[model samples]
Target: MTPLGVFFLSIGLAVLLGTARGSMRRLVLGGGLSLGVAFFAFPFSRALGFLSRDALDPTLLALVPVFPWLALVPVLGGLVWLLALRPQWAAWSGILGGGGLALLGLLAQAQPTQLVRLVPLYGLMEGVTAVGVGLGVFLLRPFQRGWWSLVLAVGLGGLAFSWLNTQGHLYLPKMVGYYKLLLPAPPGAEEKLVAEYNASLPEKNAVLKELGQPLLRPIASLRDLEGGLPQEAAEAGYRLLQPSQLQYGALAIFALSGLMLGGGLVLLRRPSLWEMGDPKAALILTGVLSTLLPAFEATEFKLQKLAKGWPFLVQFVDKAWPPNLANPEAGIFPLQSVLSEMLLTVEIALVGTFLAAVCAVPTSFLAARNLTRGSAPMRVVFAIMRAFYNVDRGVDTLILALVFVAAVGLGPFAGVLAMAIHSLADLGKLYSEAIENADRGPIEALEATGAAGVNVLRWAILPQVLPLFVSYTLYRFEINFRVSVVLGLVGAGGIGYFIKGAMDAGHYDQMIIGVIAIVVVVNLIDFASSWLRSRMV
Candidate 1:
């Protein structure tokens, strides 16, 4: 899209944001951040690369490449600190940093150009030393308690900014492939190639000398070469593996993502320091915008990129339309085959949900923080159970399905086991929360009646959270069915497996039949679940 079109579109987005946020302040903030990134931050940092190639002053230009970290880092630190932190020390930071840079520039100008250029890496050494002092001084957090955290934060923040600077490639997600394409030749390959090329030149050039053709020059560095090599050089193990491609876009990305990470950290910790008394919604939105802008840039998320996928979709539809419900295997009726696979899928979901609910019912009582409050041993159990839930939940159902498929050797049983394990953690966590929120009045009343602990739990707690548990189990059953379809694609045996077989065999017509069966069964299950929930849950 053109710049002017993008500008109008951004305005429309700002207006939409204003409507969503229900305020004018957030609209202005969103617009500023969006427009500023488009016009200022992105363009400015990209232009910084031109400084290395500037012909304005030969001496300054020469020094610029020598100490990239030194020339730009401190000025960037000062500006970020001033904008984000708003500490008492921020103003002095800017002044002292700027003054020091001015002094250094003056010294370099006054000194002999020959001496400055010949000097062995003073800029690099000084920059490294300063960074070291900044990082190391923060380790005494114990000895330096009160106001020292502020000082330590300053030291620690420098490390964060430096990390953000070097890790530019992480934030440039789209350009990673481009960078891999730019990967240079391995060490000493160029030198070896040069050696081989020079050794063969005498014999190769004799023919050229005889024909009065241009004699090939001896290869010194691969930089001197272009596309393709001479016949003799090709015979000698020469490779054009060293890529010379450069992208200046990375300079812009690093600068913006660095500020986003550093500034977000500071603002998250001390929102009062943000501009205009830290309007709560606006501050949160600002942080979100800061995070998402980088992500959008990283992922190459242009609307135009999305448009490129539509042609493939249109072609697939043209091929796949008018569903073919013919027997895939040796089945008498083709439609019954689809129904059979879908019923198998539902069975996997049913078994998974029932097993998970059974395990979760007993486990959740032990995990409830409220029930375990008085006993130290029970509290420990509670912590361990909650931790187990977290760890189990962290492993995705698809990953668990893969593991089970490996163990059980491909069937609906593997899908059932995977869904059960994943569902147990999710249900246990939900059931525990429901138990925690159960009415305390009934438990206290039952305890006062000289009831045993087990009796109190059976009568009082179960009655309160039983409805919620049923509701949660029903919901898990719904999710597990959807998950079972995915499991089939991994050879776990369901309608998804049938669909995958169709797709792999290039039977788009048969695949559409499976897809249609899946959609109809899913809707029927949802309707049944809703009616059951109304009557029972």
Candidate 2:
């Protein structure tokens, strides 16, 4: 089916279902409003150059094959079974049909190759489905007390195990090799091993040289050449592994045992637990369990090594403190250069926030549902704008900076653009929410008079929301300032570039200076923004 067809059909189905659920008047009204909105959504989006005709074709074509297998088959089978045998099982039939359709719709967008890579996700889906099925069975036969609890518990345990196995965390082979290497070798083995190890260094260095790009070479060198147990073990013809290696199996066992114990406790306390009466509560419990189980199983929980590093931390502080208050040696990044770059970072945030605020003002109006009321075309436009905001905000500033760097090449310009784009989305959403939540009384009064749409917005809406917009813009500027420093690490040009270089060359003192500069600047901005926001509010 075409995208339009699919959309209308879905709406029709929703209307039908709503009618069946005894909400005919609401269903009809909502369906009409939805259709009206749909009528103008595509055209307006197209006129704005936001909608691409080519993109729609591929999406619709992908869904074509999915509809028959997922939608038609399940619905037909359900209809036949319901008519011929169990008339009372229509709800289950609808669930099966709807679930299949939803799954197909999700899968339609993913390439087969991508799907193959997501085999682990299939286990998660299956686990969730199994839980649902077990619950359904319980609901169908509630008289069989405690049966569903046991089923759900066992199913969840199996799911946890499956997820753990898929994550490769529970794989024993790698751990076994590391453990074997930790065992001591005999006297004769040492001399021979030393000869072999010396011979291997050139080969290892060659591999490192080949793999290490200039950008990553520092990290590679630190890992491969650093004076650590791993390095020592490698030279002695062995491997060194973290304490997690020994504790991993025990952690996994404990995690699974804990989950079972927790599940049992839930079952035993079902009557008192809120989930006993609420499916939503049960679902939330299941989700929480699923997440906690994997995290508990994978966590190292070993802190002895961390405790051992306290002395080194102190030594680092001793070397880096007082920050060379006098005329210090001008390294690659001189003090003057660091100070200038820090100023540039602040400038980037200021310019970016200003640009973002300018772009966001108009877009926020389009995105505010309250402002777009009674206008189907405008409501559709609101959704599109909201989606744009969501997508831009969802992408990280660092990732955006990288893209801008690729497009516009490295420097503060790239950082500025990246910050601006991210801040635009953030500020737009904030601005829209402010507009939506503004006093409707003022807007209604203006509209009731001879005020036009634009006049109503200008006179009534803008006055209420402008202060909030300014406050949010200031807050976003502070965030952008902090993020800009990190952007410079990726060659977007600021103090972070110097900091990254200091880190790469193991210049702890310089890194400390850079960090101190950031802290002072950020605190200043935070205080100023807070004070401004307080006054604005």
Give per-model TM-scores: 0.61, 0.51
Instruction: Provide the overall lDDT of each model, using Cα atoms, as 2-decimal numbers.
Output: 0.60, 0.56
Please identify model 2 stretches exceeding 4 Å from their true place: 1-286, 296-305, 308-312, 325-333
Where model 1 places Cα greater than 4 Å from the true spot, the runs are 11-279, 297-306, 327-333
TM-score of 1: 0.61
Model 1 steric clash pairs: none
True-vs-predicted CA distance for residue 445, candidate 1, Å = 0.4
Clashes of 1: 0
4: Cα error in model 1, Å: 4.6
lDDT of 2 at 414: 96
Error of 1 at 374 (Å): 1.8
